[model samples]
Target: MDIQTLAARVDEIWAGEEAADARELVKQALDLLNSGAIRVAERVGGEWTVNEWVKKAVLLHFRYSDNREMTAGPIEWFDKVALKTNWREAKVRSVPTAIARYGSFIEEGAVLMPCYINIGARVGAGTMIDTWSTVGSCAQVGKNCHISGGVGIGGVLEPLQASPVIIEDDVFFGARGEAAEGVIIEEGAVLAMGCYVAGSTKIYSVPEGRELPPGRIPARSVCVPGALASRDGSHQTYAIIIKKYRDERTDARTALTSILREGI
Candidate 1:
């Protein structure tokens, strides 16, 4: 069936008080999966791409709106079918209410840490996802990474063409950092504490004497706090820079000052 039709059927099944045939629904959902008509749910910058059927199913299962409620049979049917069919990696902890759809990969030795991970989110091996960190739809993440507390990796599934957040290997995100608007954080880059990087934000290289305008950051560059000349020409709003840490300044006082300078 077409996406619209499938969506309508899903709505009908979810909205009604009666239960659906578990075997039949699973069979149809599997058919859509095999045909590539349905996909995992993911969002980027306020947009998401999802199978209409899955969307309706999720809404129905969650009792999402006041307009609808799911019958016990369908809910149980979905639980059994999803358990049997969904591909998920072995993890230490996961929310019983959370769902993993599509063919997204989550490798072993990685900890999910009880948060929602949408479809099309490729999580690398040995990655630790802390509390309240969202890996938005289609956000690709690399291996052995630490997504610290409250980090948001954006997804782009809507508009049918926008890119998602691509994070390369061995990166660290400080608390509450927002990387959205198809931003690409290259391998080995470290985002400092409380950095909110959006698509339109300017990224400057103080050490290289260059500027990156929107949706990009240079690879392997250490991003630390810096300053920009204010609009009123009075003071400067501190900014962040991806700079190289020189080893020549090994002296304790100089190192402390250098560290302190970046924070201010």
Candidate 2:
């Protein structure tokens, strides 16, 4: 059956008894997402569009799946979702302790270092998800990026129509930084350590004190942590755009070091 028909069924029969047809449709939809034939969100005409129907299918699948026990060598897991496999065939370097659930896409040359990638997420080519990090459901991480240790790329399944986070190509998310709630890190941006950016988090430029749109950073921006005052004059944390540069071809490691050394 077509995805449209499946979506309609999900709308009618959701949260009720499990129907075989509904489960079948959900499985097919998940398979499409797993195969990278479809995505939960994508940039079209320079705008990010949320595919609500796809999200509904993912949610419905959870209802259909019951908790079960799974074993991997000496390790055992109790969960509703199945872990992703066949990394050798897919050309992905999923290290030990990396847990990627079914229905996520990890492209070729990507290396996952003890990370957790939830359903509907996509990790692009040559990207690295460092130790203990998470790529949340439906989040789209772009190519050749370095998501450093303990970083979180947020996911969204509730408010089913909401768009997930989008990290563009070549972004360097520093260690332990957290980004969530549909935040978009534009191409080639560098986020310094412990930065927290979300839809409500203020992002401002230093010296100029200009406020930028929340949840979206411009390309090539180097961001660090800072403090800003609320209406009551209480100091609160915000992301500071310390610098924005134009050299896209610069060495990422050297460029990041320069930004750190100059603190510019």
Candidate 3:
């Protein structure tokens, strides 16, 4: 069938009254994906548009099914349909040993080191997910990045349209670092070792000369350590910037020293 005809058929199946047939339609779509007849487009505006009958099929499968059930069917379906190009040459650290939950996508050249990549999470090409790291549901990671050991990339799947943690290309996350709740880390960003960044955490910048309020961290900006006002007024938690190292002094020690000297 032609692409347009297939898309129409998929829409019809999804909108059909019967639920069982919808799942079957998804299976047909997967067949198309496996054959390289379709593609999933990641638009600049942050939309993933599927153009192949197979992607439509896989999407429909997840769209109508219960995500809580741990089934090999979904994973097998994706493995058969999702684009394997650009990732075909990618190296996997330990194949057949890495565990990926339902609806998760691990591209070629991406290495999983005994990590848990959960449902709805997508790891881009050449990205290394270190030991014990968690990529939450719907979290989108870009290409050529390094997710260090024990890091948690939070997922926001509830409320449907709510944004998930977005990490762009060439970024590096330190061990035991945490990023949660719709946080957007632009291209080439870096999170220091052991830093914990939440949605409500304010990211203070010394380079941009401004303080980023909750829920947003500017691109290419350096975030240094700072203390937030606690209830007891005794101490505060460390803050960090979510970007790549642009200079030699962008490390945690430099950030702390700068903050103390500047009294910010």
TM-score per prediction, in order, is: 0.57, 0.87, 0.64
Name the best candidate (by TM-score).
2
The 0-to-1 C-alpha lDDT of every candidate, in the order given, reads 0.57, 0.81, 0.60
What is the alpha-carbon lDDT of model 2 when measured against the actual structure? Answer: 0.81
The RMSD of every model to the true structure, in order and in angstroms, is 10.8, 5.4, 9.5
Per residue, candidate 1 scores C-alpha lDDT tens digits across 1-264 of: 666666666667765635446335545654454333454444446343444455345334334223233334457332222221232324423435434444344655555655556555667766666677888765767776677778888766453335667777667776788788777777667777676677766667877786666566556566765666766999876556766632243222122122211211
Name the candidate that leads on lDDT.
2
lDDT of candidate model 1 versus the reference: 0.57
Question: Residue 10 CA error for candidate 1 (Å)?
Answer: 19
Model 3 / residue 243 / CA error / Å: 10
Sequence-dependent TM-score of model 3: 0.64
Off by over 4 Å in 3: 1-20, 26-91, 95-97, 159-161, 222-225, 230-238, 241-245, 248-264
Candidate 2 regions with alpha-carbon error over 4 angstroms: 2-20, 158-161, 207-209, 246-264
Least accurate 10 contiguous residues by lDDT in model 2? 255-264
